[model samples]
Target: MKSKGNLWRVSTTVSQVAQPLPEDKSVDLVVIGGGFTGNSAALEAARRGASVAVLEARTVGHGGSGRNVGLVNAGLWIPPQEVIGIMGNAAGHKLMAALAEGPSRVWRIIEDAGIDCEATRNGTLHLAHSAAGVRNLQERHRQGAAMGWPVECLDAKETARRTGSLAFYGSLFDPRAGTIQPLSYARGLAAAAHEAGARLHDQTKVTRIRQLGDKWIIEANGFTVRARALLLATNAYFDGIEMGFRPEFVAVSYFQFATAPMPARLRESILPGGEGCWDTAVVMSSFRIDEAGRMIVGAVGDLDGPGRPIHAAWARRALSRVYPQLADLPFEHDWCGRIAMTADHIPKIVALGPNAYASFGYSGRGISPGTVFGTQAAIALLEADESVLPVAPVRTHRERLVRAKEVYYESGAVLTHALRPALF
Candidate 1:
């Protein structure tokens, strides 16, 4: 069968309404963008008894939040030490502590909200694609251990047994991480937020945002809103509204394909423990088995762009190289999402004048950081306490040569996908 649309959208059991924005209204806070961050912030704000409104340009989870690989991983892509080196010991440790608990925080929300997003806490495996990759994981394991993180490094034999494939050199298993139906998680958050008194409006595109005296003025879809605090959580899907400050980051695309449910016997051997996995290749690829036994694999490239054929072929080849038994299976669903990659691979919280902030640039790590950042940002804004933010808010952030970097990334993915002749 030809590829369907996004697998999460098709498989998600959770749902939310897309109500229109009410005009000429005012509230304590106005959140732009209705993905994980906005919905999360709105949820926290409303629960704290602050009047809040969320305006989503499109449907909830329409952006990266809906389109991710769903590996609710902890911490950023960079090493723990590197984060410390960049942000200093105190700040780094604070952010790391916050993110390291990200999975639990998410699970708590899921449990309290009773969100049924195929929630699994079985953990995740970071597969080593090569001997060098093994060394890299060893270093990561060491760093994690130094910080008292519960990370374990598995040998090649254990890795093979866990992955049901003899492709990896080794693997790093992080018990703190897991997987979920990402879109469902976002929708469930939105639903819970609405129930908690947050006014959420989808399909409401903001045309302009400006500071009017002490209040923030937002004009969207012929509607106006005045709020004491504002959060632009648009991330990679920013609509470029006439806001004075725009977040800067290179947009990189990641695509995923899912196969029809495998037979019980076959599925039982592959990822039987239900750990989501990703490899260490530069052009990284991720794989996992959903609750229904469907095998989903993802890689860093656009499946909807000119390199579609190249990426598709690479995906098939990569899958065969790892799990040759599943080579004959055809993908039944495919979709792509853009990532807001900062040069430093760190998320940013840009201060947008007084009582206003814009957050973006999670690189590829969204689920946890988005939740932590969103939740904390809400509390900080509502209480006028910036100290609660995980990352220090900056007055301005800029990325140079964003377009060129985007082209460079896409070209690299195309070239890499087009020509990796050896076994991975």
Candidate 2:
């Protein structure tokens, strides 16, 4: 997975690209990967007066950070109790409590650093695609409310008014969550890090990282960075550093298509509140309106794979099915990015070696979780403490039947999308 420019970079007008990594140098921290997590770690560490250097295989936001759905959501996809079910009581509670404020952290950074990436704080919707979906939302609402989250369940009428679509039976709305220009946010974080004395390098991939005594020797871009700590925040786009347990997870592809900005009348009536949305289905789908008024819809399956046509046609039909008023609106931009999905659908923080860690497997929730993990991972490394991390650093993380699971995911998405119209 080398650097591939995405729709975010093409459409965004943010100015935060960094030069390549230095030929050779020594720093307190070396962050491998310029996505949300790595950049946040660098920014956090550097702001605290630590000398930091961040290296990216491509330009800033070139990875999943640039290609994500841009949903700045709080918490994980599941409820707090389900989080407990996965990671046990104490650890799960700690992780959930920390991530519960993830969106707030992002908004605070955006405000403090003045990063203009279309920061919308209105809210986000978890729509129910069917009666079963509504029941799922009800359970989620119960769990969320019990955990003190101000989650609201909107009925069919409110859902229709908020989304300007009648496709969903209901929706679970979270006021703490919102949307952003993901690529711009990534670039903004890099710029803020650089301004805070962190050295950021683009197009410089770390080929190898080995410990020399207590310090780390990170080799990349025909140079080496000798640092006391290192953070691997590559997420779903690990190009190099092919050593150790590199966060085993299925690389599920998610594609999005952005339509041309709608006319004012249509825009006013469609998704009038500027809330990001995703439906609750086995093979999930998401849609949002950007600051420029363009509608971006996304779902599983690769846009460049054998299921390309199936996925593309599914997108067109799904968009029409959801928003009949905007049917036949041609999509202007179509792209795909990989998601690092663990078997448990939870993120992992793997302790690579002494003073080194790699955080990945964000599932599809990158923006907030990436920030939390990256920041905590860096703090843990700098402070020599694993207690600060959301997930206790694990020595190793593994995935089974990866290739088979990848096929299962794609085939399942294609099958679901192919049959969705009739099923609905």
Candidate 3:
């Protein structure tokens, strides 16, 4: 069934006016893409007394930032040891430590800015879908504990009690992570950035960018913006604009369906502690309860494509298997968004030019990483200090066979949803 619309768009309490580009302007920084990254950078740069302007093609949070699962998880999808193996000790540790603070940074911003996004810090659960998944969680818990993180390994009975379902072998709980109304958080960032002296223009798509001496010139909405630094934060929803450099990653689609608010009794029994959750299956799924008591379930695959019916049917069966009490509940909202999945699942910071950077490839861990990267990118760019950056900036990054990889991912998701047992 076609979705009524994005639940976040309809339910988001935070609002910001999308003003057009006022006129040709000069600033210390020009940010393209007003999602979490761009807006966070804008807010940071402006707070540091830099002249900043953000140009967004659509309204703030119109991209994956608005349509995500809203899981404010810490670290990347890969475990910390894998990250250290790939990036080596120093750089890997730097990135992990920075991202480990992701949830707190998000909460701090919400508190300081008085932005109400239904902010919750109760933590998140990483469910084990099978015995192999259990081992994976055990390894994750070991790695996190070695890093001095407060990660706990829960038994099957405790997992069932916490999640209100007996669908898993065990679970890993991270007290640092949480959930939020993602769209509202994006809009709140935009609003806070605007209040902190950053100029933000929505419906302003940048078409061209060029460097003149030490300044970067941006053309958008028939206006010219010359700045000393630039940040391309479009991620998976990058519009077709030639900014001399393109961020590359395999774009994978993820869709979600939300049921209407359940009764208080039902809501109290399911996820009563307000934890967000996702399983360890290869084609994983996430489920969480919103502030209004609505249960949202999401997985890989395009909900608007030919596999829509298959995915929609799978959603019902999957939810029923876990929470049989909600089997007859009808989904009232559905939406889909793309994730910029990197080969190694590590985010990249590309040095576009002198004092300029473009960050992408969060690999489905956008909220915390985006916030950390955006804030660090701004500080590193404005202060001319590469050491301030979480990850060392590279000259260029290229992903081969992006389209084919996208197809492979979507097809795998569709095939799994069609053939996998409901008990899984």
Candidate 4:
């Protein structure tokens, strides 16, 4: 329902126009959902001189796009070999190579469009939580290097120096990765699309879509728009849309808490290299410092759910465990967002019909992949080509144990957080 928590609403301001849909209109393309994917698609299509319109059930960045962890990392959460294993050699390699350029594509767009979203292109650290975790990083580093990725496997001593915390055993640092103010970035894309002659309508919920003789008729709030092609980019916020497209993915929630800006001395000592970080634990946790010096920590669970207290307590303890100097500081803001977790943990581009597609399921890695998929999907539809696309479009995608998996993720996170002391 709600798009953002205190951090987004308080720290960022979106510049997109939310005019209601007109009584009747026609465009070369129509996009559903106004997150990064929809907005990026609209921007790409519009930039190519195609008339485009974007419909949003809620305000811009109202889903994972706005609430994301903002790690603009290359590739998926899994190793390159795992990706190749899942999609098979050809398709998986195509996807992998395509996404390897994700961070560059994202940052270039940000710079080219002048999107002021606090983008820091320093890099990211995939930390190892324990001795076993170090083994995982070694393998990831090896695979990444083999694939020509600029990855570095740091020893624990170097990890401590870079992170300013001794909690991690080692780290896998990818120089291609970076961070951004997610909500601001999404809005920036929307604004760029609008400037490029794309029409974006917010608070205009599309009730139904029916193909009408060479055109797609989209019935929204109080109007109908006819388009030659259609795109459904509503990653995790599809329930609000009435019909036509249903993406099957297990839902997982990720929550983040930001503390008040640290003192200059403390800030300099923490995350000295300014790289965002997440660990190798099964129930992983992330920590990073924003431009304003707030230390934002996040994990995989709904902070507003029944386990809110436990999640909050775990965050506090986790903070102390890593950086005890800031343990006395209080959290200034907290929020949560849902992730569309596919059965295989890969994003899907489902072909709805001729000239139509729905893209979803980025798991927790939404920023880079969402932007890449959105831009590429638009190009593929416009040019009637799939070669440039990451993965071949599927007619349908489903996850069988959706509800069960959702519960399992949250339960695992709660149990892990509740039993944090024993593990740490």
Candidate 5:
């Protein structure tokens, strides 16, 4: 799919690893997708001595993995207490504890691989946009602190000082979080996997997948490849392969606009602490600085179709509202992508067949969860032990009414963006 605007047109620094599928070949593990999850799984599996092959419909990281907000956050979109409430204490706690170290694990791999994606470990801020939002941040701080997380609640003044934006009432800072060039990071993983002896096939779309005897036959691009195990990491970009098991979720679109590199004087005053930020609004807004010092502001909306006008208007107003200093800053880039969201907002790992699994539904929180889940999935498949996985693989579940939900989300974003400036 073509991107909507220039935001995705910015050149990523990561070099693409070269490997395309042979006319006919077989591997121990077949990973369908070349994004973070698939590449991470391939890397882990290959490191464990399993022969792995990764198939990408496009180039590696061409999906949402390339167009993310770049915040390397450490937890799920749902709070800890709510997660426990939904999944029961034991299961939820297990998942939470495993993911609590997600950012560290991601950075360790980046450092060890010597991938230069401009990884910065400063931290992240969950900004509170209203009085109620402040209360929410307070609760998050308390819960995170109780769990031994390095989280601090900052008052409005402190938040403004750090962010250079008085648009928030308060903020929750978590030292466990950070940011990266998402596309470069994903490509880095692919490169590491390639170096670790995994074969990566770009522009090879998997058209049909079926079980042939005890082996899995995956047909793509006029060729067939057999594998002992298969892993489906195609989240929102999943086409028509019905594995008899799929994620129960909706596809919500999120758009981003990035300005050209700010003046050196203004860059120091804006996001000086090098933390990525997002506000606590129903229709949330995110702001962060890229490695090149470009200010990227994003929100939940469709960058394509007629709703583009609404999103464009809101983005302009939002930029002015946050930093009047950059009121006239020309937005040079704009892009959007889909996020898979489960009804309960938790990711799922579903067992589709013997030695086959599919993982999806990270909502908008992909970086950490994708790496953690992909790595664990590789271990589980290679070692024949699911004990190491953060979430247990299930056999089957009901798919959500995704079409209706997607329409609803887009409609809501369009309406909200159309009216946001007036309310402000």
Candidate 6:
């Protein structure tokens, strides 16, 4: 069967209006790709009194931003201690401290902008799928406590009570985490940016970017736009722009399936604490409920291919295994998106030219990091200060075997979905 054109059809229904690009124009800043990073950067830059124009190949949030699982998690996928170990004390501490308030920043923006994205702040649960998983959670709990974070390690009984599933031995609960309707949130950002005086253009594909003397010239949709500065916020959807540098990362797919709204009684019993959750399986699985009582079960796979049935079946079985009461629920919506993963699982902001920068490689954690980094990037670019950035900008580097790693992740997803029962 042919795949659907838009994986996030449900979200597009209420999204903001898409503005057309100007025929020939110039702006202080031209942002490429209208995902979370682009929209957030545009909003911040405009708020800072800079003339900004955003060019999106499709609608806002058409990529991973729209297809995300909507978990507004604080920090990256790796724990704080692991981050410190990788980057040493000073740099790591900067990143950890900056991102520790990630979800708070995101929620504050949503509330201040009056975005109706089903925003929820009940918190998130990190379930342990195995004994080793439980041990890892314990270590994370300790590290989080040391940092004065509001994180708790729940025992098996408490975990079951919170998650409505006895399949896990233990879990980690973080009050800083929450969930949102990702597509709506993305569109809301675009709307807020527009309201803040940023010009947003949908279906405006940037074909080329080059530096002409002191200014950068952007060619898109049969027009040219000259800007004093440029921001390549494309992330995984980069289309070969000449930014003088590229992010060292590979794209991996993550998919989700949402069931029809469940009965109120059943919904109350399942995930009663209203926390978004993901387990510690090798090929991780996530579960959460929407305001409409729809159970969304997600895993790593391309849901728009021949493996759809396999992934769909695995989701059904996994849901049944975790919450037997809703075993018969039928999924109503299924979708997938690509996540940019770096070698060290860290996000990067590279300086491509005098006033040009490219930020990417979120490694499947976009919500809070995207907002925090984009906001900071706008401030740094406008004020010519790198001190406000979440992570130190990469001076210069080359990605080792990125193509091979991309293929490895895609092939691994296929094999994992093909052998679902055994693996799950």
What lDDT tens digits, residue by residue, belong to model 4 across residues 13-103?
6566767786788999999999989999999999999999999988989889888888898999889999888999989888998889999
lDDT of each residue in 60-95, candidate 5, tens digit only: 988889888989998798788888899998999999
Question: Which model scores highest in lDDT?
Answer: 3
Candidate 2 residue lDDT tens string, 94-133: 9888888999999999999999899999999999989999
Poorest lDDT segment (10 consecutive residues) of candidate 1: 415-424
Candidate 2: which stretches are off by over 4 Å? 1-5, 422-424
Query: Sort by lDDT, best first: what order?
Result: 3, 1, 4, 2, 5, 6
The global C-alpha lDDT for each of the candidates, from Candidate 1 onward, is 0.91, 0.88, 0.92, 0.89, 0.86, 0.84
Cα lDDT for residue 43, candidate 1: 91
Q: Residue 388 of model 4: what lDDT?
A: 67
Model 3 steric clash pairs: none
Clash-forming residue pairs, model 2: none
As for candidate 1, its clashing pairs are none
TM-score of each: 0.98, 0.97, 0.98, 0.97, 0.96, 0.95
List candidate 1 stretches off by more than 4 Å.
422-424
CA shift of 147, model 4, Å: 0.7
Instruction: Give stretches of model 3 more than 4 Å off.
Output: none
